[model samples]
Structures are given as structure tokens and as C-alpha cells.
Target: MAVQALKDYKFSPADAQEKFHGAQLLYVGWDEHLMFCAPFAYCLPPNTLFSDLCQKFMAHSFGYHPDWKSVDFSKVTWLKSGQPWQPDMSKTLAELGLKHKDVLRFQTPGLKGINGTCS
Candidate 1:
């Protein structure tokens, strides 16, 4: 299965961004070279490979065991800390009309706080 996926995956940055046409994105943070595209429209992460996001998404989405070291995540756009997240988010969420209850769900991120973030 692993070999098959790797062989068939046409991992392209442009293809990914296009797949999520008009998706309302929430900037979680940066990973490797990719941004975490968590959309407010659904509790699940948007189908974007903004970093190594696609690998984890594949693991979660397919119920596969994520042996990160074995995965060749050389396709992400990595960034560093203390750097601005490009399109700025301070004025971003304020534009949405969503309520607190609307975004609440089991898979909602940050619920685990720092514990879930620590490597």
C-alpha cells in the first residue's frame, strides 16, 4: 500500500491549492515549508499540502500508521518562527460570521493545547 501510494501520488503545489477552490482557510501555523490550512467551513483540515500537512492528513484520512521518517515529505514550503504568516490573520477571522458553537467539535484542534503540539 505504501509503495503504491508513493508511486501514484502526483503531489503538486498548484494542484492542491486548486483542489480547495474558495475554501475559507485558517492559519494554524507553519510546518517544514507548508502552512496548515485549517478551514473554518469544516472541522477537518482542508485538503491542502501547505507543509508536511498532506502526510499527516493521509495518515488520519486513511487510517494509516504514520512512520514520519519513512515518508518523503520533500515537497513542502518550509518557514521559520518569528516570521509573519504572510497574509496576516489578525483581521482575518473577524471577517467571518461564525459563532463559537459552530466551530466546536471532537476533532477541533487546540483542544489538547500544548500537549498535542509537543514533538
Candidate 2:
């Protein structure tokens, strides 16, 4: 799926300052059956990469997994509002319209495969 394009809104450093100070928080969890580890709270920074957050979540909560290396980043999905959340890893949290206490679910790359197909 394609990532959402930026809207016609204008952004300035002053606007960024307000958002930075009032940054939101998020809850991230693995999909069902991979729920052994507890979900963690994240301070949603304006410029945090989704992939970086995923790596941090896996390492901190579940320790090392052999299958991580073979996983495809593009196939990873973050869901909110029944849609993929920010499919582009390079996009920042602010760009994706993420909000306070937003709950997100991630489907691991290799676990579900793209469109449920075995890769």
C-alpha cells in the first residue's frame, strides 16, 4: 500500500515548537499469538522512524530472535483506523498524524507475509 501524501497545510518552526512541546504518546503491541511480551509506551517524537521503534520494541521486550534478520521491512504493517499506518519508514511520526495515546498494532514481516502470501 502507498503511504499518504502530505496535505496542503503549511508548517513552520513555530508550529513545530508547539507540537514538540506537547508531543503525544503511543502504545504498540504485536498482533495476536505473538503477545507473550508486554506492550510498551512510547513518547511519540515528531521525527521518530517507525522501523527504529519496531527494532527497539523487539529488542527490549523479546530479546534476540533469529528470524529478525530474514524479515522484510517493507512488508511490516502498522495499523490504526483499520489501515496501514505510515507505510513509509522514512516518514516522521508528525507527518503521519499520530496522536496522543494512539494504539497501534504491528504484524511482523515474516509472520503474516504480504497479503497473507508466503514470501
Candidate 3:
């Protein structure tokens, strides 16, 4: 349901890209992993390489999960903003067409949380 404003509302969004200096806002999530509860938000430079993002940022964010060790990037299914995506690990986020506030979700095949409970 769309929200209808009872009165004229005009204001800038606090989370706009410009508010983060040169960094862009990115959201990443692991599918069927409820341990995280929600996606992780990151403020990073657009020039950050996809490989670095996964090896560094994602590792730090989701590394504690039991399934993290089993995740194989080659076999994982990736989705960008809810659509299927095949990212070039060698390319930077900007080269991959990822913009501020974009969401990247990855689902590891044969892995669905600990004991397949989606926890």
C-alpha cells in the first residue's frame, strides 16, 4: 500500500548518497540466513573491487556464520536488486553498475543455514 501524505511533505532524505562523502551505500545479504536478520549496510568507495568487497567486507560481516566456510562463489547464485546477477569478481563495484543503496544477495547452493533450519 502506498502511503498518502496528509499534508505536503518536502525534505531531503537523510540517507542520500551525497551524505556519505565519496563513499556509496551498499547492502548485502545472504539468503535463508536468519542469523543476520537483515542485510548489512556498507559505506564504501565505488572503486572498491568486487573481490575485495567479498573477501574483506563480507568476510567480516558474515564470517561468524557456520555456513560461511562452505560458501563457494563460483557455485553461489547472486542477485542484484532482486534480479539475477553475474558479477565480475575482477571488476570494481562501479564497473559492475552497482550504485548507491543497491542490494546484492547471494545464495549458496546446498547451504541453507545450520542444519537447514535457515537460522
What TM-score, over all chains together, does every model reach?
0.19, 0.56, 0.90
Superposed Cα deviation of residue 8, candidate 3 (Å): 5.9
What is the descending lDDT order?
Answer: 3, 2, 1
State the local distance difference test value for candidate 3: 0.93
In candidate 2, which residue pairs get closer than 3 Å at backbone N, Cα or C atoms, i.e. clash? none
Cα lDDT of model 3 by residue, 1-119, tens digit: 55589987678899998889999999999999999999999999999999999999999999999899988988888999899999999999999999999999999978888788998
lDDT of all predictions:
0.32, 0.60, 0.93
lDDT of 2 by residue, 17-90 (tens): 35646666777766642434555677657577766666665556544444455555577667885577655666
Give candidate 3 regions above 4 Å deviation: 1-8
Task: Give RMSD to native, each candidate.
Answer: 15.7, 11.5, 2.2
* Model 2 ranges with Cα > 4 A deviation: 1-21, 33-37, 65-70, 109-119
What residue pairs are clashing in model 1? 32-78, 33-77, 33-78, 34-50, 34-51, 34-77, 35-50
The Cα error of candidate 2 at residue 71, in Å, is 3.5
- Say which prediction, candidate 1 or candidate 3, comes out ahead on lDDT: 3
Question: Candidate 3 — worst ten consecutive residues by lDDT sum?
Answer: 1-10
**Taking the tens digit of each residue's C-alpha lDDT, what string does model 1 give over 3-113?**
476366765665243354545333233232112333223333333333332344333432232223344433322222333222222322333332222221112222222
In model 1, which regions exceed 4 Å deviation? Answer: 1-11, 29-81, 84-90, 93-119
